[model samples]
Target: MAPNMADDVNRAVSGARPRLIVGISGASGVAYGVRTLDALNDLGVESHLVVSRAAAMTLSQETTLSLAELNDKASVVHKIGDVGASVSSGSFRTLGMVVAPCSVRTMSEIATGVTSTLLTRAADVTLKERRRLVLMVRETPLHLGHLRTLTALAEMGAVIAPPLPALYAKPASIEAMIDQSVGRMLDLFGLDWAPVRRWQGMAADAPE
Candidate 1:
C-alpha cells in the first residue's frame, strides 16, 4: 500500500476505542440521546457528542438535568460550531453517527447536505463515508414536506428511526418506555442494551 494511505488509516485509528458520534437536536425526548450515551458508556464505546443550541433549550424545558450533566454522559464533547473537531472529518474512523431527537430542521439540513453546524457536518461526513447514519426523529403529525424530506434522507442511505413507545414491553413508567426505544435504536449499530425488552415466543409464555 502507499505510504500516504497507510498513514491516513493509522491516523483515523489513533485511539484504542471504537468511536461513535452523538447529535442531540431540538426535538423533544432528549432522553433518547442521554440514554444512548449511557449505553455507550456501559458498552465501553467512545462517544463524541455535539449538541445544537436549540437542543440545549429543549433539555431545559423537558428535564431538570443541566447542560453540564448532559455533557458528562459523553466520552468527548464538541461544540456545535466546532467543525474542525475530529468527528467532522470522514477520515476519523468511527461506527458512524446518530442524531437522537432529530428535529425536522436538522433532518432537512443533513438530507440536503447543507450542513451549517458541526452536528450536521459530522452527519454529512458519516454519510459520505458510507457509514451508518441514524436519525431518531421525534416529531408527530408529519406534513407532506416532512415526509418528502424523510424520503430524501432514506434515499441517501440514512435510517429514520422514530422513537415510538412499545406497549408490548409493558413499560411501567415513561423512563422504561424511553429506554426501550433507545435500546432498539442502538440495535442498528449492533449495540445490545440491557433495558430493551425482547420479544419471546408465545410458547415461552404458555404453561406446559
Candidate 2:
C-alpha cells in the first residue's frame, strides 16, 4: 500500500525525515534518482539535491522528466559547481547522503577524495562527518578498478549498493523495481518506507 502523504509529511517533520542530500551522477538509471526524490518528498523529508552535468545527459536519455520537473521534487536544488552550498560544510547537519545511480567514475573520484565539484565535495564532507553515505552504483560486469574503488569506499564506511532488483518482491512494473531498490537505499539511513516489499519465506506446505 502507498503511504499517506499528509501523515508521512507530518511524521517526517517531527522525527522521521532525515536532513537528506541527494546526488545524481552520470549513470543510465536516472529513474532511480527520480523515484528516490519522490519517495522522500512523499515522506515530507526536506532534501538538497545536486545534479551533475553527466546526469543531465543521462536524464535526457533515460527519462521524460525535464530539468524543471526534476528540480520541483526537491525542497532545494544546487548546481554541481555550487561550492557554497550548505552541504559542503561539516557544521551543516544532515542525516546522510545518497548518490543514486552512482557512476563508476564518480565512485572512484569520491573514494579518492577528488572534490572537483560540489557533489564530490559534499560527499567528502559526509565522510569527514562520519555520516552514512550510500552509493547506488549502476554498473555491470565489474572490472578490477570498479571492485577496488568500491572496496575502498566500503572500508571508509560507505554503503556501496548497486541498483539490482529483487524478484521475490514481485514487482509488476519498471517503476516498482526502481522504487524497491531506492527504498532499500533509504533504509540504510533509517528512513521508513512501505512501497518496497520485504523478504518473506514461501508459504507452508509447499509441494516438494
Q: Give the poorly placed runs of model 1, Cα more than 4 Å off.
A: 1-15, 204-208
- The residue-by-residue lDDT of candidate 1 on 1-208, one tens digit each, is 1113233334435767677899999999888899899999998888999999999999999989999999999999999999899999887888778999899999999999999999999999988877778999988899999999999888888989999998989999999998999899888876788889998757756787
Give the distance in Å from residue 32's predicted Cα in candidate 2 to where it truly belongs: 0.7
Worst 10 residues of 2 by lDDT: 1-10
RMSD, model 1, all Cα superposed?
Answer: 4.9
Q: Kindly list the per-residue Cα lDDT of model 2 for residues 157-203, writing each as its tens digit.
A: 78889988888898999888989998888887668777979978777
* Number of the top lDDT candidate: 1
- Give the C-alpha lDDT of model 2: 0.84
Give Cα-based local distance difference scores for all models: 0.88, 0.84
